[model samples]
Target: MDQEASYGFAPTEFEERVARAQRLMGQHRLDGLLLTSMDNIRYFIGVDSTFWESYTRPWFVLIPATGAPLAIIPEIGRAIIEKTWVKEIRSWPSPRPEDEGTSLVVEAISGLPRRHGRVGAELG
Candidate 1:
């Protein structure tokens, strides 16, 4: 696939939407959000090209109020995740852990400035 054109599909209005979502998040009193579902993450970040390869790695994205969002993905996605919007990507090599790498997700959520932390999670 031509990343050039396909990726540009949603990047145009992504920033504005992100701002809008952030505002909505604030109004809803959410400290931040953890995105684990592919659809939801794509909706928020405007990039929808994560598919599992030989490995069954889970994909998750975290959007915080103050800083850039983070991407927690399977090792197979390392290249694109790094090359893509989320420069900060936490990876899990296969042989999938029984815990399913929730620890990293939790840690990322923990790092959020949750003083008034009403966190939003996409549990799909």
Candidate 2:
């Protein structure tokens, strides 16, 4: 069993949260949501980790208008993140001050459907 499975939210609970977010996204006509904060990511995907303490790596959770949430994270956290409900995970090497998953994030956002898709990000 995965360590996260024991402590994280149940699969159904995660699904409910995702459904609620998707509903709101649809109401607002958003193509997707970009969640960079640890709290927001955990809320959406149930990925609780102390590893977020280090600023060396940035983690992202992209909640599309439909379907499951996608996690864009560092390779170091892959094992732990895999334990969460998020199934579509994209990983990159950490501490890469130059890039730091910037391109990966851009690509992920660009892949969303709709030529003029609107993606919402949590700035605060």
Top model by TM-score, which number?
2
Cα error, residue 108 of model 2, in Å, equals 0.7
- Tens-place lDDT per residue, model 2, 1-124, is 7644653877778888989998899888998999988888877777778877787788988989887888899888899888888888898888789987888899998888863379889976
Inter-residue clash pairs, candidate 1: none
Q: Pick by lDDT: which candidate is best?
A: 2
lDDT per residue, candidate 1, 38-69, as tens digits?
66766655555636433356778888765677
CA lDDT of each prediction against the hidden true structure: 0.70, 0.84
How far is each candidate from the true structure, as Cα RMSD in Å?
3.0, 2.0
Give the residue spans of candidate 2 off by over 4 A: 1-4
TM-score of each: 0.78, 0.90
Evaluated at residue 94, the lDDT of candidate 1 is 60
